[model samples]
Target: MHDTEALQAKFFWFSPGDMTDVRQFFAPGRVNLIGEHIDYNGGHVFPAALTRGVSLWVRPRADGVVRFFSVDFPETIEARVDELEFRPSDGYANYTKGVIKAVQEEAGTLFCGGDFFYMSNLANGAGLSSSAAVEVVTAAAVRALMAYPLDNARIAVLSQRAENDFVGVNCGIMDQFAVAMGKAGHAIFLDCQTLAYEWVPVTLGDYALVITNTNERRGLADSKYNERRSECEAALRRIQEILPDIQNLTQISIDRWDDVETHLASEPNLLRRARHVVFEEHRTNEAVRVLKAGRLAAFGQLMNDSHVSLRDDYEVTGPALDALAEAAWSFSGCLGSRMTGAGFGGCTVSLVRRAAIPEFEEHVRVAYADKTGLQPSFYVSEIGDGVHEQQKEGLEV
Candidate 1:
């Protein structure tokens, strides 16, 4: 449970002299352990929901007016349930507004106004799925407030819809699914094509999943994400000329790759993209194997390989990202390090021994600062559960 006293103090600071009852809802941010850009290419993604994320203290209003306040933003927002439209000026609240519109489509008769006071420790635009966290939390809040019929998976789907149609970011289901279905101490092995998944126990015997944000903020909708996906699609189309049975880049094997090697060699860019997607899928499969076999070292090596492919072949890592991951490689305790997420510039997930985390952090901080002239931040992430509601009166999920 979160500290109730601190929450009450913060809540009072925002809305003083108010005695409205509220419920807290929380959704966890996520980190992709391996398997980067291939999520939409019909590949597998290994991700775990993190402990840090967005939280909301929401209470219904009889006036049917929606109001939003956040410690992170300067201004408070007010609107009607009927006027929930996307306004670029609204910033983070757009995710909330998007969710309201999405859920309203499902439960049209249950539209009601509410006040939402939000705060989060998650670093926005740092490749931690903060937007998805906000949308999922908002979806849960709406469901709880109206007593609507929706499960976490249903909420995740609607949240993805909000991002795609409402928020205008064409993100895949991995972020939403992991944030909605996450189980503590486990990483979800998800087939992006089929949406079939399983929880793999994350038994990192002596190492921890450390996140180092390069602080080079990136917005996915504005990044090269769509272009990268299109490249993979184009590559898939080219390969299908030779292997008529192939559906996605994932189905093309290393042998099949050899068969069509010359065809792809003519188009180096398409070849590189297809190679990364194919190898990344294999790496994800291998990663699951190593994790299940209790082999952390091998798992760490796959992380290294994944980053190399993303860097050299995929070409998504800018100088900031390259510096961060390269610096992590020099750290004593770090077994492996890779740039995670859409990865124009964001964070790197590193596997480091628990005892050496402080040294690891200081080393990367100094090295990254010296290289980029911008200081970076580090967080030792914990795998946590998906979105859940905190009952009335400060109960924890």
Candidate 2:
């Protein structure tokens, strides 16, 4: 948990302001439990928000100058509300500037700038959606500052727009939505096609969700993420000729794909990409059903299956992710393990028995280090709430 007093003191150190008009906001990073590489395919995704995420302290400025500071970086970035644009050199601050521009455009009105101080416990490039957390938290603070009449769901949509339009990453809505509207002790079952969702209770009786980072440092924009998306699109276009009503790859059932697979035999790569989407979509839906029924073993099996499809069919998981996941799978206490996120290199989430967490960690740690020659980081995940104000007593903006 984050220390409010400590964060407030750091905020004062950075901004040199009294606590009179400062409002604090928090947005959690998310872990996709069973869904991998399927959100863009218009499939159902199962994701839960983690306790680790980004927190921001905002003090509205009288002028239009917005100053951004982070505990993770040395330099404070400054921008004008009227001139928010993406700059490659700006690094992480681009997410903040992107959200500010998105809010101004979506709300159809300009808002005052603010001094934004950020602090986060989330590991960047760990497949924990840190960028999404930053975007959502910024949107929440800007909404509070400008009194925008948008709900949490709308906040998610606009944040996604920031990433897609401003940040130039063609990510789906799962990351932003999971971070913006997550409920504690529950995994959201969301349909990417229709955006219909429901909260499913995560009842892991004696099991824990452990996230292991490969420390390979893969960037989403520079990685093969966009290439996989393009391949899926190409497959969808070819399949559309056979079934014109079909919208996305996930819309095709496994049996339906068996009937249509012969048509795409000429393009082997496209076949594999589409195969992953269709089958992975089925696995995700079944995982949700078994999880709701407390069939944890079945849910774990589905997680393992999701990883295989992601590895063989989608061709996303690299050597580091594969080594970590395979090591976890060899442990007897681990119920399931799979590579999560966009996955050229990132993290693997494993469901392990609570009593065996120590052994599980050591086993995987030694094995992964031996195979990859790099140390991996581990975090025991705690499900948490979405973006909201951290209210301070007797303080109002």
Candidate 3:
């Protein structure tokens, strides 16, 4: 509620008098530490849910209209329980629309009209998957409300569909799935192809995950994220044609990479995209092993290597991300750092020592601004719960 209180009052447009039954809410944040552009290639991704999420304050509605407001944004959006409209082009609004459409498509439940409100502290496009958090929490609330199906995996899939078909981003399922189903103090090693996952305990001795905004101007959904996904699909299709056996990019071996490389030669960009996905899957597994062995510095170097590959081979990272990672590696207190999101500017995730966080912040802050003329936003996060609720005392009509 500390974070929720910071959103807005106007978007709600509802008085305490109109409040009804209080319901639970939930959402998740994603840390794409490495393994970028790999999920669509049937690669394994290692993502952790940050100590950030979106929550809902929802109750029953009697008037047949489901009115809503974003506690985070400063505007109100209203739609009938019967007539929820889809704003396909808007990034933020579609998150809400996606929840409704996905749940409704699966169970076809009605809200019976409720006034819904939400709040999130997760920074948008900070490579944090704030959008997926909203979708998951909102969808969970609806599922509880209508007494519809309650499957976490199905909920995750529906959330992805909303982002893909309704929102039109063609995103993978990692963001929604991780946030919807996460455990505190653990990272999930997810195989995107098999929908299988194992918990990797993240015991960062005397350290925490530090996320810094590069503030690089880049459109996430439009930043060639889909083009990379498409290219991987093409490579997979071509490999399938020749071998008639390799089903996913994850199946290609180092010996077979020669075969894969030949097909990608004509399209350098696509080839680079394939290189990131294929190589990233390997890094994800190694990072898991290194962390398990309690070697923080070792794991940190892997993060550095992954960033370099994303920067040079994948071509997703730009100068700002590069500078941030470079500066982090130079500092003694910094363990590892790399661009975190859809690259070409957004945020960098760094592993930093607890005793050195302050100095680390000061060094990177000034260095990034001096190098790029852009001020970066720093966030300190721990592993947090998905979504929950509490009873409220308020006025009612």
Among these predictions, the greatest TM-score belongs to 2
Runs with alpha carbons beyond 4 Å of true place in candidate 2: 1-10, 219-221, 393-397
Q: Write down the RMSD of candidate 3 (Cα, Å).
A: 2.9
Which runs of model 3 end up more than 4 angstroms from their true locations? 1-12, 15-20, 88-91, 390-397
**lDDT per model vs. reference:** 0.87, 0.89, 0.76
Model 1 misplaced stretches (Cα beyond 4 Å): 1-20, 219-221, 391-397
Best by the lDDT measure: 2
Model 3 per-residue lDDT tens digits across residues 1-397:
3433333343244535444456646566878666777787778888888876776777666776766676556666677766766764343766777678677778756666666776667666667888888888777777877888678777888888888887778888888878877778888888888889987888988988998888777765365787667777876776676678778887776667777788778878767766777777888888999999999988898899899888888788888889888888888988899888788778888999988999998999889888999888888778765544444543211
Candidate 2 lDDT trough over 10 residues, lowest sum: 388-397
Clashing pairs for model 3 are 26-137, 28-179, 61-113
lDDT of 2 by residue, 1-397 (tens): 4566766676777778677888889999999998788888899999999988998888899899899998788888999999998889888899999999989998898879999988888887788899999999999999999998889998999999899999899999999999999999999999988889999999999999999999897855245888989999999999999989998888897778876689899999999999988998999999999998999999999989889888899888888989998999899999899998888777999999999999998999999999989999898998999999997763222
- Model 2, residue 150: distance off in Å is 0.9
Model 3 — which ten-residue stretch has the worst lDDT?
Answer: 3-12
Please give the lDDT score at residue 191 for candidate 2: 93
Candidate 1, residues 1-397, lDDT tens digits: the string is 3465776786766655555467788899999999888878888999999999988888777787888888778798888888788899998888888888889899976468888888788887898998889889999999988889999888988999998998888888899988988999999999988888999999998899999998886754355888888898899899999888989898878777776678888899999998899889999999999889988889888998999999899989888988998899898788899999889778999999999999999999999999989899889999999998765654232
